[model samples]
Target: MMQLENLQPYAIVEDGPFLRIIFDHSYISLLVDEKSYQFIPAESSEIFINKELNKVHNLFDVFTFEKGEEILHVTVIDLMHMKQFRTQLQQIIHTFYEKRTMIPVAEVETIVQELEKENILRLIDRAIDEGEEHSFLELTNRLSEYGGKVEE
Candidate 1:
């Protein structure tokens, strides 16, 4: 029962080949070299220094993406991490709701102005609907940095 207001924003960390998204004691770490990921969910509201602590009963794996040559792997995540990451993704999507807060007014107008724009907007919308939280935030952050008004 954690709210975005209650949880701290996730921070991305560089650990050699791994990119660790950390929030207090919990983390979702991505391995750049292997195109793999390892996540360690938080123990509780109480802080712990051990990154591998698992309070949940079973360790689970969720397959995210696979292409002919491209691959991504996510390994070792507890249920709590999944739940919290889901919430965080929801919050990010809410910010980019169809009401159009984060996307610039000019950008919106431009999209509407073109008759055949290939509808990147629709693709983005679909991504919001079907995409995982980590990927969603990563894309949103990049868009924000490029031009969109994604929350900081």
Candidate 2:
């Protein structure tokens, strides 16, 4: 449930208290008979059952959801590890965000030389700042012919 939207980085464990999970500012725990225990990274009822049943003996007719079907013989260690694997997992998440896109910048001096316009330098600067691929390509193609010779 914690992974449905936001993920948590840490978890708390209770030995004899009601099982509960807290994220941010909300609490998700279960209390019964004034006794509860909370498993970090919370798991489903099936995982919990598998854990308890496996401890005494292998469940031959027990339905399991691990592989989408019921299976017998779930190890207690497997259940414990399965319940709290987030601690070993990286919690970094990259949400959808608006960021300034980077446009490929190239020195197009060769294309600027071909432009017959007196403001060739101005045109080149505009092309660089425009951040448009087609515009820069077209400008360079048009200016490729001039190859202005610098007067020594």
Candidate 3:
């Protein structure tokens, strides 16, 4: 079994026709199959399950590793956002790898931060469009702290 001690944050890579996640060099990669991915909200402990044999199953339950249990729990919206973010990041990683050029570790961090800002702005815009006053106020306040400009 692979040790998880040196596991780094996930980064997407294209493995032939599938996109997979590499969690540092020491761990086994996780394949990204959006069709089987699931998102569970923290507020509700319950997840949807169709009764088959008194078992509760979720979308994520379709995948399994020999020695790994649940490694993450996130909201459904966040999961969707993550999928989008991974696709963007994969392009950057692939470019650097293909060119045989070294990209500074710090650059990766900056990219992540910028992507986060974009996601935040998107959420704020969505809230505004949906007429969610509380969500807009909260999201905009958070965005401003990140030096993001909010247009009234």
lDDT of each residue in 4-31, candidate 3, tens digit only: 1222234544444333333332232333
> lDDT per model, in order?
0.41, 0.33, 0.48
**Root-mean-square deviation of each candidate, in angstroms?**
22.9, 17.1, 20.4
* Residue 52 lDDT (model 2): 25
Off by over 4 Å in 3: 1-101
Q: Which should have the higher lDDT, number 1 or number 3?
A: 3
By lDDT, highest first, what's the ranking? Answer: 3, 1, 2
| lDDT per residue as tens, model 1, 33-138 | 4443333342322221122331222235342223235544343353245665456534533443434436788998877655323343344566778866676666
Candidate 1 similarity to native, TM-score: 0.23
TM-score of 3: 0.34
State the weakest 10-residue window (summed lDDT) of model 2. Answer: 89-98
lDDT of 2 by residue, 1-152 (tens): 21112234233222232212223221222222343323232222221221222231322322122212422232334433433332322121111111223333443554444345446545665877887767666656655556532222
Best by lDDT: 3
Question: Estimated TM-score per prediction?
Answer: 0.23, 0.20, 0.34
